[model samples]
Target: MTEYGYFLASEDYGPNALVEQAQMAEQAGFTSLWISDHYHPWNDVQGHSPFVWSVIGALSRATTLHVETAVTCPTVRIHPAVIAQAAATSGILLGGRFRLGVGSGEALNEHIFGDAWPRTAVRHEMLEEAVEIIRRLMTGDEVSHQGRHYTVENARLYDVPDEPVPIDVAGAGPAATELAARIGDGFITMSPDREAVDRFRHSGGGRQQGQASAHGGMKVCYDTDRDAAVRAVHQRWPNMFLPGELGQLLPTPRHFEQAAQLVTEQQVADSPIPCGDDEEEHIRSARAYVDAGFDVVLINQIGPDMRGFFDFYRTKVLPRLAR
Candidate 1:
């Protein structure tokens, strides 16, 4: 059976709200949690970005939900050595329930360091090196490297878990999927692109697992007024509508601003983001992820009515899939 999970909007909500959401998700019987790691919320309109690592620590104490960084960029903003230590500590704090989901990050987050944002090839090279360093450190090994991209001298992690934490690599293209297959313990992605999944497997990333996120289908708007739900989503998550390279490269807040210029409330209302009162549409959207061969599917509730989302998913969506 495929496992169903929910994503914590670490960028959209405050820390307290995130903790509350995790508790609610656990009570609602979610199998896992995917938390986004962003330094900024992309746009002022989208709202918050409160240090993802701190949020993860709190979530570990607050809920029994299995947690993973939906995808953290360990390449530029933070050195891989720091990432190693953080992941090791988080692994211990979460009692071995944490999965490190990593990817080659965007300039929005990494460029904050005032370093030139290298092209995709260079970023991937850095990611490759970073993953190697992180893996070695996770083993509690004394690592000293002088690679072209990164260097670590006598670096070691003392607080690593008894078992090594699994690392999931997020990829959108064939080259990245292949890289994941070659270096990552598992693969993480957003679309239902089986072709990419196959490429990942073919490239040698078959051991751990495959996970994906579906954006539009998970929104649960239980208001008696369905339009109210849609409007809330438009105001809160307009960035979801942006297209082209900018959508993929820009940070959350910037993306939101650019998208707002193009996508009106009406477009979001008509799209797949689940604004209607029907529970079946939500189930259909969630099922689409399962049909796409994802071992794990993370549904993101885009609006404010999270309680309604949880209640509706528990009563209506989960049962249908459990059968």
Candidate 2:
């Protein structure tokens, strides 16, 4: 069976709002929670970036849903050792129901330190090393390490969960998917790409730990007015539609906005994001991920239609999909 979850966008909502949304989602029957950790919103129109750990702390107190960072970049802005400490505490606070989902970060958040953004290969190397460091620190013993991209000296997580916190590695391609299989406890991706999921499974992903989850997320703008939905999504997330490494290289919101301006509203209207209030359209978007072998799909309701979307999803969308 394919489980369903709600994705809480920290880039779009404050801590209190997110907690409220988690509660609402739980009441509405979501099985898990996915939250993004970002230093900045994708665009200014998205307009919020709360510290995700604080919100996660609030979530632990507010809901029982299994929570994971849809993907956190431990290689930049924050050191993996530090992330290890935070993740350890979160796991404990959540009664070991927290998973640390990680990935190679983007310049939008990783470049705030003024450090040069490494090339793609270098970034992936750093992420691999960071995951290793996080794993060692979770052992609850002192750790010291020196690697190509980071340095750690006698740092350890004195507080940790009873067991090692599960790692959910995010990937979009063959190489990343293979690496996720090598070291990750679960696989996380936004796209419904069967080849990637198949590669991970064939490369020794789900065999261990009984069955590692293949977690996916997607955005849907459920509004009565399709034009308004298109405009709002275009304003906030056109950057997601940027191809290649452009989204990874651009260092500022203005740079992203400039790039996003080239994206036409027609493109947003034509994009994969499921828009409008049609239950069939929403279900189809979700089934694509489930068909691709995802164990769970976290749906993000874009714009101001959260309650209405939840109502429709609980009453209409989920039942049909669950069958």
lDDT of each: 0.79, 0.89
For 6-61, candidate 1 gives per-residue lDDT tens digits of 88877788889988998888888788898988887767765788888899899899
* Candidate 2 local lDDT, 1-323, one digit each (tens): 88999999988888888999999899888889999999988888888899999999999999999999978999989999999999999999999789999999889999998988999888889999999999999999899998988899999788999988899899888888998988888899888989989999899888446544698988998888888888878877888789988977888878888998889889989888988888888988999998999988999988787888788788888888888
lDDT of 2: 0.89
Against the true structure, candidate 1 reaches a TM-score of 0.92
Cα TM-score per model: 0.92, 0.97
- Clash counts per candidate, in order, are 6, 0
Off by over 4 Å in 2: none
